[model samples]
Target: MTIAEVSEKFGISQDTLRYYERIGLIPRVNRNKSGIRDYTEEDCKWVEFIICMRNAGLPIEVLIEYVELFQQGDATIEARKELLIEQRKLLIARMEDMQKTLERLNYKIAVYEQVVVEKEKELKRSEN
Candidate 1:
């Protein structure tokens, strides 16, 4: 597929796709005879993986390192696994912190709701 097609299909900008290639976030895409990018199935898979990792909050440098390790062939398997495991641990910690913040916000909202209800009751009693 052409870069335009890939961009539309993946919901990513064309410039971003080019930037990913330039930054080595993804492997270089093969170009057609006319010198336009023509993404193969493997290229698309790389784009999908990169997008997923980025959405998960993985750092760009970490992802670049992972891609480099991947290019180094089978010897980096254990290293790749360790990198992912470490990232997973960090993600879990961030999730836990976000959960605490959510709980605190919920509690504050509930308190305000209860206060509003009590005020309504007081107003009703005064009217009576």
Candidate 2:
């Protein structure tokens, strides 16, 4: 696959793909004689992993550390696990915060509805 194909498949922009490569977020994609990117299935899979981690709100620095540890092979398995565990905890906390915000929004919506009803009652009284 080429860069265009990867970008389309991942729903990411080509510039983002180039940026990822430049930032060492993903491994450098191979290029053909023409110096155009020639992405392989393995390379695409790595990009998919990066996208998933990013969607999960994983920080880029942490991801870079993960990638570094990953390149070290089996010796870094424990370290990688620790990184994932820490990230998971952070995600959980964020989720909790979002839940509280949702609850507050719901409460405020209910208050608005109550005010609307009160205004409607006032209008009905004025009509009488």
Candidate 3:
């Protein structure tokens, strides 16, 4: 697919796609004779993987390391697994923290709701 097509299809900006290529986050995309990017199926897979990892809060450096390991051939399989395991742990921890924050926000919102209800009751009582 063309770069524009990939950008639209994936909901990723063209600039971000270029940045991913420049930073080696995803393997270099093949260019057509005109030097425009032509994303192959494999290239699109890498883009999807990187985008998912990024959404999961994986660090750019970690992803870059993973890609480097991937490029090093079969010898780095165990190393890549270990890296992914470590990153998964970190993501779990972050999710736990986010859950706690969500609970706190819910609690605060409930408190505000109760206060409003109490105020409404007070107004009703005073008018009676």
Q: Which candidate is the best by TM-score?
A: 3
**Global lDDT of each model?**
0.97, 0.94, 0.96
The clash count of every prediction, one per candidate, is 0, 0, 0
Q: Candidate 3's residue-wise lDDT over 1-128, tens digit each?
A: 99999999899999999999999899999899999999999999999999999999999999999999999999999999999999999999999999999999999999999999999999999999
Q: Model 1: residues >4 Å from true position, as ranges?
A: none
For candidate 2, report its TM-score.
0.91
Better of 1 and 2 by TM-score: 1
Model 3, position 73, has a per-residue lDDT of 97
lDDT of 3 at 16: 99
Looking at model 2, the pairs that clash are none
lDDT of 2 by residue, 24-122 (tens): 889889999999999999999999999999998899889888888998899999999999999999999999999999999999999999999999999
TM-score of each: 0.92, 0.91, 0.97
